[model samples]
Target: MKFQIQRDRLVNGVNDVMKAVSSRTTIPILTGIKIMAHEEGVTLTGSDSDISIESFIPKEEDGKEIVNIQQAGGIVLQAKFFEGIVKKLPMDTVEIEVHSHLQTVIRSGKSEFNLNGLDVTEYPHLPQIEEDSVLKIETNLLKTIIRQTVFAVSTSETRPILTGVNWHIENGELNCVATDSHRLAMRKAPISGGNGDKSEAVIPGKSLNELNKILEDTSDELEIVITENQVLFKAKHVLFFSRLLEGNYPDTSRLVPAESKTSLTIGGKEFLQAIDRASLLAREERNNVVRLSISEEGGVEISSNTPEIGKVVEEIQRKSTDGEALNISFSAKYMMDALKVFEGAETNIQFTGAMRPFVLRTTSDDTILQLITPVRTY
Candidate 1:
């Protein structure tokens, strides 16, 4: 197999596929990237049995040629070495050729590297998914959804299901929810076109994060095909597949209170910055807890204490305050995470009581809301 591709294009393709490469795998070939050069373009694939990413560089994009394929063949090359080689290449183009006996060679500028390649036949076959169950979403919107929720997913393996983001589509609305027991993030958006059929899937947070990193064009839409155990995100020139978590995601709708006893409307940035500064002192504590006290007449105050490292107390003028006064303690890190997701000028926070989970959202928008369980400071 032999092909010449623009150095920049190949570098991007390698970077995209490398997201799925695992160095420590039972199957050695899984540690490498499978490269296939065909008549249309060159396809690069990487997988670790859980998440798989494939990037295709076509022969020509627009009026320029991105790749020229001389011979059609497939082989696997070590991802670690190939990634480094492509990035360091000092030229406008890169040439890859594989000879008999699995001898692979890479050349660019004044540098050439020869490495042994694995037979493509030994590579595990990527899942073949049907398009019967498919949903389309804007790339940027999907990225934002992942960014806003995946941070709340549990990093612990104790409850494996909590490590995934739950997605459900019904009545032309798509909702995504992620929680780690302590805090939860949920976003709801209207699907441009839908049949109103209900479908749900729990995708691993790690996979969504990786896919979000590779999605470059927000204007482009991607199709998602769901199977019994797998979900596929099909983009313009990239295909991402992730295995769905086995267990069901816990129902958390009841966790959000319909009414609140305390409410405060404050600037999102100002509130987030206050928590950010307060966390410095709270960081020394085990849970990085910060206390928020709100008064109908005195506005809101954020404070944190570290016995040995001093403490910090700051106040942000509230746009409006109502209901009962609140004295709540919560993880500073969790509050910051929720605040950063709010892009609007101000956010409204509601507290049912001192010990209840607080919900945060923009007053003008109800599509996305975040819930935070306060830490008991007794």
Candidate 2:
């Protein structure tokens, strides 16, 4: 196989696919990237069994040639060395050629390097998803949904299922939810052509995080294909596939209370800053707990204390509150994460009681909701 490609174009393609490449894999071939040159363009694929990414660089896009393919074949090159070589190539173009014995040669203006290449045939094939059950949404909106919720997924592998985000589509709305049993983040958006029928899937948080980084926030629509065991995301010239988590996600609907006993509306920025300052003191504690007390005079007091570190106390004016004064303790880290995604000027936090889970959301927008389980502190 032989190809002469624009250096920058090749670099971008390599970087995008490298998100799926893992350096420590039992299968040695999985550590290499598969490069295939065809009549249409050049394709780069990286996979580690759990996730796979394929990026295509067409020969001509917008009437400009991006690659000039002299031979049509495929080769697998060590991802570590090939990525470094492509980035540091001191020329506008790169020349790559592979011999019958899988010896790869790379050349630039004044640099030449030879590396061992493996037969592309040994690489695992990516899952072929049918286009039957597909949903389309704006790329920007999809990224927003993932960003707001993926962070809440559990990093621990004990439960295994909690490490992935739950995706459910119904009534033309798509709901994405993630929780680590302590805090939950949920986002909802209208999906084009999505129906009321219930369809559910669980996708790894790691996969969604990588997808968010690669996707461009634009008005362009992305097609999502869902099957029993695999989920596929298709952008303009990129295809991302992830293996779905096997167990059933916990039913979280019942966890969100239908009504609240104590509700307070506060400025999102002010509340976030209060928590930030309070967490500084609580960081030394195991739970990083912070306390919130709603005053009868319509003000909220935020405070945190540690045995080794001094306490912090701050007050923020509230928009409105109902019922008796409420005092609650929760993880400051969870509160800060939930507040960062607030889209409006102020957010309404509804507390059922001092020990119950509280809900935080924009009063103006009903599409997003965040819930945090209170930390019990005597």
Candidate 3:
């Protein structure tokens, strides 16, 4: 296989596919990236069984030649070395050629390197999703949904299912939810041409995180296809596939409260900063808990205490408060994460009681909701 590609374009394509390349894998070939040169363009693929990514660099795009292919063929090269070589190449173009014995050579400018390549035939094939259950959403919006929720997925492997985010589509809305039992993050957005079909799937948080990193914040819409066991995301020349978790995501609808005993609206930025400050003191404690007290005089008090570090107290004015004055203790980390999702000027926090799960959301938007279970500061 032989091809010449623009240095910058080659570097970007390799880096994007490198996200799926695992340094250590049971199958040694999985650690290498498969490069296929065809008449149309050059394709780079990387996979680790759980996730696979394929990025295409066409010969010409927008009347610019990105790659010129000759002797179309395929080769698998060590991802670690290939990525480093491509990035440091001191030239405007890179030339790659593979021999019959799987010997690969890369040349650019005055630098040239030779490495042993593997037969692309040995690499595992990516799952071919044929079922047409697909949905489309803006790339930026999808990234926002993943960013707001993926952080809440469980880090432990005890219940493998909880390590993934639950995605449900119904009534032309896409709901992404993630929880680690103690806290939950949920984001909802409307899907174009979406019908009220009830479809549920669980995708690994790690996969979504990788996808978010590669997805550009563009106005272009991304096509999402869901099959029985795999979810595919296609945007322009890139294709991302991830295996779906096989267990049912726990029903979280019941966890959100229908009413609140206390409700307060506060500046989102100020509230987050208060929690950030309090967390420093609370870090020495077992739960890193911070206490929030809604005052009858229309302000909220934020405080935290540690036996060894002493305590901290601050107050922020509120938009309004109703129902009852309440004091609740919860993890400051959870509060900060929930606050990151709110883009509005102020956030509405609804507390059912001192011990119940409270909800935080923007005052003007109901599409996004975050729930945090208060830590029992007994």
Candidate 4:
């Protein structure tokens, strides 16, 4: 295969596909990137069995040539060396050529590197997904959904199902929920162009995070297709595929409380700041626990204590307090994470009880909700 392409475009394509490449794979070929040059464009693919990413650079876009294909062929190059070489190329154009016996040469502006290329036939085949029913969502909105929910997925391998986010679609709305059993995050958004049928999939949080990093924040829509074992996301010039988790995701609907015994309305920034300061002392504790005390007279206080160290108490004013006065203890880290994504001027917190899970959301938006299971300190 021989191709001369714009160096910047090649760098971007290499970077995007490298997200799927892993050096620890059992298959040696998986450590390299598969490059194919065709009449239309150049395609780069990387995979490590669990996830696969493909990026295409068109030969001509907007009447400007991006790739000039001298010959149509394919080869696999070591991702580690190829990525580094492309990024440091001195010129705006790069040339790649393959000769007999799987030998490849890369040249750009007075610098040249020869890499041992693997046979393209040795690479594993990517899953072939049939796009019968496709779901479309805005690029930025999808990134937001992943960011808001993926963080709550369980990091422990004890319950493998909780390591992924549960995705369910009904009535053209997509609901994403993730939880580690201590904290839960849920987000809902309207989608378009599905089969008009109910659908559910459990996507691994790691894969979603990688996909989110590659996707640009834009209003352009991306197509999504779900199969029994795979979910595919297709954006302009890029295709991402992730294997679905095998087990059923636990039902999280019942975890949210029906009503609250204590409710407080406060500014999100102020609440976040207070929790941050209180966590400074709480970090030394086992669970980084912080205590919050609310009074019937609308007085709010956040405090934390460590026996060997010191105690921190901060009195923060609340906009309004209703229901019964209560004292609660929870992980300050969890509260701060929830507040960062809540994203509004006012935050509404509803507590079922001192030990029950509490819900946090913006007063203006009900679609995004964060729940934290409080800790019990006797």
Candidate 5:
């Protein structure tokens, strides 16, 4: 295999593929990135069994040549050394050639390095997904949905299924939900090409976070394909695949109350700042509890009291309230996380009771809902 490519283009491709490379993977070949030069372009792939990323750089985009292929071939290069070499190459172009016995030479300007390459034939093949159950969504919208819910996924592996964000598509609507038993987040958007087929999948939060970094912040649409155990995200020149979690996600629909006893709307920034200031004292208490007192004429006050430290109280003017007055205690960190996803001027919070879960939604968008369980503090 021999190819001379633009240094900058190669660097971007290598960086994108490296997101899936991990040295501790059980599969030895997965530690290296597969480089295949075909007639159309050069394909670079990285995988660790759980997640796989493939980035393709065409020979020429528009009127300029990106890769000048001398001979079409393939090789598996160690990701650690190859990644470092591409970034440090001091030239406009890089020359790579693999001889017999898997000996590879990389050259740029006045630098030359010889590294032993592995057989690309030994790399595991990516699962081929049929295009039957596919969905297309805007890149920016997908990123928004992820940010709005991915934070709520459980960091612990106790439930396993709680570590992934549950996705449901039906009736031309797509809903993504994540919860860690204490707090939950749900976001919905209308899918462009929904076939009314009811399907659900649990995708690892870690995979979505990595995909968010690789996706471009644009309005371009991307296609998604899902099978029983694998999911594929196809962008313009990049493809992301991840293994789905095997456990059945718990049914959480009943957790959201259909009616509320107390509800109010407050300025998002003001409420966020109030909780932020209150959390400073709660941080020393270990539980990070913040209390909210709502009254008919006293407005709203957010306070946190710690035995070892002083207390903090902030009064925030309510935009509107139309239900019974209530007092509740909850984690300030969880409340702030739910508020950060709101891009509106105000947020609407509905409380079922002091002991029940409360729901938060942006005043402007009913499509996104965030819920957090209140702490039992008398």
Candidate 6:
């Protein structure tokens, strides 16, 4: 392989693919990035079995040359050294050439380095996913759906399925749900260009988080294809693939309450601040529990206490209170996380009882919901 590519574009493509490279991978070649220089462009790929990412830099975009190719071939370079060298290259262009016996040469300006490249053919092939049946979603909306739910995925390995977010697409709408048994988050959005095939996939939370970081914030549409065991996300110049979790995600529809016994409408900012302050004391406790008390006369108070630490009590006004007066305790971290996604909008919280799971939603939008189980306190 012989090619000269713009330094900036090469750096970006390297960074994107590097997210999937892991040194601890069992297959030695998986720690290296496969670089293929073809007639059309230069393609870089990285994978660790669970996730694979490929980024392509076209030879010319918008009539401007991005890569100048002299020969067509492929080679695998150690990701750690290649990534570091590309980032620190002294010039605006980088030249790579492969000689016999897999010896590679990298040059930029007056700098030169020789690397022993691996056989690209030894790298595992990515899953073959047909794109005929795909759903399209706006990049920004897809990121929103991930941010609104991926955090709620269980960190524990006890129930492996709980470590992923469940995605269901049907009826021209997509629903994403994640839960850790203590808290749940759900987001719904409309999709386009689907073949009307009902599809379900459990995507590992870690994969979605990484994809969110790589995706640009734009109105451009992203293509998603879910097969029996692998999921593909295709964006401009990038392709991401992840293995679907193998177990069936637990059914969570029945967990949401049909109705509420106590409901409170409060300023999201005020409630978040009160809980944040209260958590300062509760932070010393095991669960970081904060207590909320509501009075029939529409008074609201947040309090937290730790015998070793001090107690914190704060009063916040509610926009409206309905149903029964109630007191409930919950993890301060969970509440704060849910509130941050609301983006300071007015919040409506519905509590079925003191001990039941409570739901939170923004008054302006009903497409997203957050639920947290109240902590039992003596």
Is 4 or 5 the stronger prediction by TM-score? 4
Clashes of 3: 0
Off by over 4 Å in 2: 194-197
Give lDDT: candidate 5, residue 293.
Answer: 90
Q: How far is candidate 3 from the true structure (C-alpha RMSD, Å)?
A: 1.3
Candidates 2 and 4 compared: the better one by lDDT is: 4
Among residues 3 or more apart in sequence or in different chains, the pairs in candidate 3 whose N, CA or C atoms overlap within 3 Å are none
lDDT of 3 by residue, 97-138 (tens): 997689999999889999999999898889988845678999
- On lDDT, the stronger of 3 and 5 is 5
Q: Which stretches of candidate 4 lie over 4 Å from their true place?
A: none
lDDT of 3 at 246: 94
Q: Indicate the residue-level lDDT of 149 in model 1.
A: 91
Better-scoring candidate (lDDT), 1 or 2: 2
Give the alpha carbon lDDT tens digit for every residue of 195-278 in model 4.
899999999999999999899889999999999999999999999999999988888999999999999999999999999999
Judge candidate 5 at residue 87 and give its lDDT.
95
lDDT against the true structure, per candidate, is 0.90, 0.91, 0.90, 0.95, 0.92, 0.95
What's the residue-level lDDT of 273 in candidate 1? 82
Per-model RMSD to reference: 1.4, 1.3, 1.3, 0.8, 1.3, 0.9
Candidate 5: tens digits of C-alpha lDDT, residues 1-378:
899999999999999999999999988999999999988889999999999999999999998999989999999999999999999999999999999999999999999989899999999998788877678999999999999999999999889999999999988788899999999999999886645578899999999999999999999999998889999999999999999999899998988999998888999988898888899888645679999999876488888888777898888888888777788999988998999999545899999999999999888889989999999986
The C-alpha stretches of model 5 lying farther than 4 A from their native spots are none
| Deviation (Å) of 72 in candidate 5 | 0.8
Off by over 4 Å in 1: 192-195, 296-298
Supply every candidate's count of residue pairs whose N, Cα or C atoms clash at under 3 angstroms. 0, 1, 0, 0, 0, 0
- How accurate locally is residue 308 in candidate 5, as Cα lDDT from 0 to 100? 75
